[model samples]
Target chain A: MADINAIAKQFTDFYYQTFDTNRAGLQNLYRESSMLTWEGAPIQSAAAITEKLTSLPFEKVQHKVTTLDAQPSNPAVASILVIVTGLLVVDDSPSPLQFSQAFQLIPEGSSYYVLNDIFRLNYG
Target chain B: MADINAIAKQFTDFYYQTFDTNRAGLQNLYRESSMLTWEGAPIQSAAAITEKLTSLPFEKVQHKVTTLDAQPSNPAVASILVIVTGLLVVDDSPSPLQFSQAFQLIPEGSSYYVLNDIFRLNYG
Candidate 1:
């Protein structure tokens, strides 16, 4: 079995990369059953999540991860729980907002797709 | 079936209350298989988590939750994935540190115990 930490690292890299470069393309990372919570607002399903993310007020955003943690949730389904703390600069703004995000990734064939995702801005 | 959001709210209330009043008593919220990652450091088992939490530098701490989100992870095991963003004041400090925590709670009889817990401070 692949190490959960390694897989989480890879997923975070791919996730933020796609999120920064192309927000709409993030839909591929989710399934029909996927759920996304953005700043306490719930958005369900892949297409809706993609739409919500793409419709963000800022046009450009970059995330710099400060910490990433993961643990195996269920060996039966090979699901991994990953949490990330990061700084995000939106629209080339000098002020970066601190944020945290959690993702539950479950196996889909040889790879994984996000099942549960929750995000929050940590500071005002 | 109970709502995951309600359960998550209850858990957060109990957790922060126990944490602020009696840090040692928070041990009951975990299981032998529990994993805790505190600010990127990994601690396994309930005992270790309680110890780590209790041994923090501050004598008094309080958590004010800003947002809480939860989603049903596995119906078979009745596991819920919960994420919280909050501000923590340590030792009555004027500055409140922003933080985020994630929990994977699985049913144990009528209640739930944390199986995976991860926490991180949002900023330096």
Candidate 2:
């Protein structure tokens, strides 16, 4: 009874906006109880997520989604693959970082959020 | 164009047969260049795969597939979620091991081979 495609689009749009200035619009995309786990930071809460985002001086950020696979008729869930490229504004020099992330989406009612995201700093 | 469904079944059948006292019928399923990587042994060749199976004594092995979601009409590839439940025939006692594996299927004509299988020994 849910629109998974619409939910997936909204979830991706939030990530796209996060690059504008640190994680400017990231918080709005997740539920208050959202959980984030990664290498350096195994698990984090929504507040921690926001804190980590603005910790870096990012001049500009861009992301490219490689794959978006959704199960048929499963409006509440989807799997997404993203390649994030960002520039760190530090020491008056810009250094870029590339990341690949696999996201698990969960939709509640008309709104959708990310449940789990496994990411790695890709070098290859 | 190959049938992805058939290929996946064959791959699973080979794994099921490998638990019969030894790898009785595993060689026929894999290509000569199959690469196997796990925690204990990072990478292993076909010979190594065969050796690992027979190294342990087993009266029987059984597997249950939980999810089998495949790309439509893409017979050459599919992503499978398998729960392999097996008994280890050590000390003449049957100890069950449950494994969750994500398999990457590669089909060469009528025969299908596994390109990658990432598995973890699940506890819980």
Candidate 3:
């Protein structure tokens, strides 16, 4: 049986820690066997994902999680709503974006890894 | 027992009809006693809702329901994902907004009405 609260926390923490200048902490959160799909892009391996993240131009990216709704179904599956308040420090410009984040999570051992994520921004 | 497909259709049609200048068709889709919540606004009557819609600057509005996933549990509750591709003609400007639309549906007799909706837009 998977502890849903712990899984959800690890899932949320993955995004929050991505803000760090050192990408190793964020990369460590995902299992080497994990899959992460963003938008409609091709499924990437955890190592590939880490490489992509570290290549990004932004100096720092902070995600303040606003909501965490977890729905877990034993060993099969789990889903969570992770609404984040985004602040990106890029080129000395601070851009703030608010969005409701949804992550489809799957568990491996006691920890869970993200399968797919949808970040829907709210703007006029 | 309510047909899940039928309920989903009616809910989607309501938003599409609102795009038409004739407000009555859209109004007809909702039960007088039905509750519709958008954003985090207070509950308002169907009549009040109609007034609010008609008062908007948009001369026309259309909702393209891209996806609908329904979960029904007997007479107690149901939920549907209604993703709308929105196009609003406001002040002679055509504004396009793309987002995933979610409706929390509750059944009343043979028909299901929306309890609340969350629309999350995607922007860079």
Candidate 4:
């Protein structure tokens, strides 16, 4: 059996690192069928997702993950649900914003890609 | 205009209070159509949900919410998506576990009910 926990942690670490350093590089992590509910709006397609990422209000951001949990879907499907809680600092903000993000990752080839993702900040 | 932020905060506060003091009171917050993906298993119906809640591994638990965010669904639907990050202390454990929970709440009468909920701990 694969070490799903370690894989989840590594994926989260790599995902956020790429998110901060190379936003465009995140392209490889999604497919055309991927769906994202960002804050409140639903966005589809890899291209549109990438567009939304590039248009984020913050110019610089850092994610400090405190908790990462993974659960594998039943019926032996090669999919996992990952939940994350972390603090995010955007553009040298004095106070870090708290965030909770969830991702449904599906296996493809040698790696996994996000099938569905939902993200929201803790406060308005 | 209703202050969605305040409403979200109040909802969260009320939720954890009920969860800690009176788990049975949570029955008012769910209906026959409610669905929950807890940890990794899929559970449906109010009766089953309550049964599962009563059978939790820990006897006592406390939730400390750090972040709560809400987004009303589009098309003027009386539905909102709520994301929460918090800590959970179970059974006198010295260390607390990190938790992330998401709920799709739909308005029915004077209050809202959970339509879909997902919860996961951030570790194995």
Best by TM-score: 1
Tens-place lDDT digits, model 4, residues A42-77? 787788999999889899999999766665532245
- TM-score of each candidate? 0.95, 0.40, 0.46, 0.59
Q: Model 2, chain A: how large is the TM-score?
A: 0.63
lDDT score of residue B34 within candidate 2:
52
User: Positional deviation of A122 in candidate 2, in angstroms?
Assistant: 0.5
Number of clashes in model 2?
A: 0
Ranking by DockQ: 1, 4, 3, 2
Note the residue pairs that clash in candidate 4: A68-B122
Question: Model 2 TM-score?
Answer: 0.40
lDDT for each residue of candidate 2 in B1-124, tens digit (9 for 90 to 100): 1354455556666665564534645655555555444422433456666666556444454554433322221212333222222222334455554343434444467555654444444332
Which ranges of candidate 3 are over 4 A from the true structure? A1-10, A31-40, A73-92, A119-123, B1-124
* C-alpha positional error of residue A18 in candidate 2 after TM-score superposition, expressed in Å: 3.1
Write model 1 residue lDDT over B1-124, tens digit each, in one string.
Answer: 2488999999999999999999999999998889998987889898999999999988999999998999888757678998998899999999998888999988989998999999888775
True contacts kept of each: 0.93, 0.00, 0.00, 0.17
Report the C-alpha lDDT of model 3 over A1-124, residue by residue, as the tens digit: 1355456676667556654556755566455544443322333557776776677666756665544434331222343322232333345555665445445455457655654344444444
Q: Compute the lDDT of residue B60 as modeled in candidate 3.
A: 55
Determine which window of 10 residues in candidate 4 chain A has minimal summed lDDT.
A69-78
Regions more than 4 Å wrong, model 2: A1-7, A71-96, B1-124
**Candidate 2 local lDDT, A1-124, one digit each (tens):** 0354454556665676565644746766555545554432444456766666666455555555433322221212333222122222334444444343434454457555654444444332
Task: Give the least accurate 10-residue stretch of model 4 chain B, judged by summed lDDT.
Answer: B71-80
